[model samples]
Target: MKLKLVLVEPEGMINFGFILRLSKNFEVDELAVVRPKFQVDHEEVLRFAAQGKDYIEKVKVYESYEEALEGTKVCTSAKVSGTDTVRDFVLPWELKEYVGEPEVLSLVFGRESVGLTREELSKCDLLLHIPASKNYPVLNLSHAVAITLYEVWKQYRLERGNLPQKPSEKDLEVFMRVAGELAERFVGDEVKRERILIGVKRLISKASKSELRSLLYLLSRCSSFLKG
Candidate 1:
């Protein structure tokens, strides 16, 4: 299992720096930032990033949530309450069942204040919430990243039971491109396109590599059949 830490519209530079270190601490391979307000090369952020700056520099900046998650399964972390889709918050241990298959995982963390919006949450196949005290159930961004990444790595080790090379970025891109094409074909209504895309993205994110490949093959066959 490969994991990337995505921070969406983070406000503070210090938090960014700390999270960068946390990514290194947890051995996260990729880091992506979506529409950040602060400068990536800011002194405060750089100072803290320090040795982790190498990873920080490699951080991909995305204009939108969808673009950032183009080639990976994105799991968004959100608050656990209200009329939200978040019914039962899955513990870190339960995360094992969600992962295990060979796939790239993008663990998305939203803003420091408000977590992922309902619209953003819709894109995520699964919602991961740190089980906090009911009294006060909010966590800092860096802390959340640390906890989530740690749990994911732990579960990955247990399930994989063997070390293997992760899928290349090019492979992930090809898969996502195929998925996008399939969505465009099957889901044509402009009014409902957004909704269908979200659902489809969620479904694909959870699929194993083999399953995704199978879906791509099926999609290709369907396209060929139409052309024929």
Candidate 2:
């Protein structure tokens, strides 16, 4: 399970330095930043990084947030996902289950004062929110990173056994399209069609290889019958 930490427009010098140390401590494969607020080698950042200052040199800088998440399963963390009505979110500990066996896991953290924007959160594959007391659930930038990274490290670094392989993106898309077409042909209820589409997507992400192949074959036969 490869890991990458993505900081989106990080501003606080101390928080950035602390997160740098946490990246090293957790053995992150890459530390990417999107348009950082200060110079990567700023004195204040270096001073707080302490032994982890060397990791600064390893940071990959990017102009846009999407560029940093290419070829990886993108997970964005926030105190509260304001757009939850339209978007689904997961807890930090459940991340391993949510992803579809991605080659790299890219964990994105937003700015210090405000978390990820509604648009950013919508684009992510997974919206992660740490469980906290309702009384005051807010957490600091570095603290959120630490908690999320720790949970991820515990899940991936200490694996118990072999894991199932997820279907490729191409196959999943084809399967989903076919399923949607089938729904359109037989199901007239718009609400029911929407429900079926959502379930089909979840199935594609978690089904085993043989299972997915079987489903594709079945769907193909159904489509053929409809044509006949």
lDDT: which candidate is best?
A: 2
lDDT of 2 by residue, 1-228 (tens): 678898999999899899888888888889999999998888998888889989987799999888988545555554554665434678877877878567888888888778778788766777778878888777888998899889987787855444565678888888888888999999999999999899879867888766888999999999999899
Worst 10 residues of 2 by lDDT: 78-87
TM-scores, in order shown? 0.64, 0.65
Tens digits of lDDT, candidate 1, 122-199: 777677778778788788888878878777767765345344334445655676676667667777886687777667
Error of 2 at 215 (Å): 55
Segments in model 2 whose C-alpha atoms lie over 4 Å from true places = 77-87, 159-228
RMSD of each: 19.2, 15.3
Error of 2 at 25 (Å): 0.4
Candidate 1 pairs with clashing backbones: none
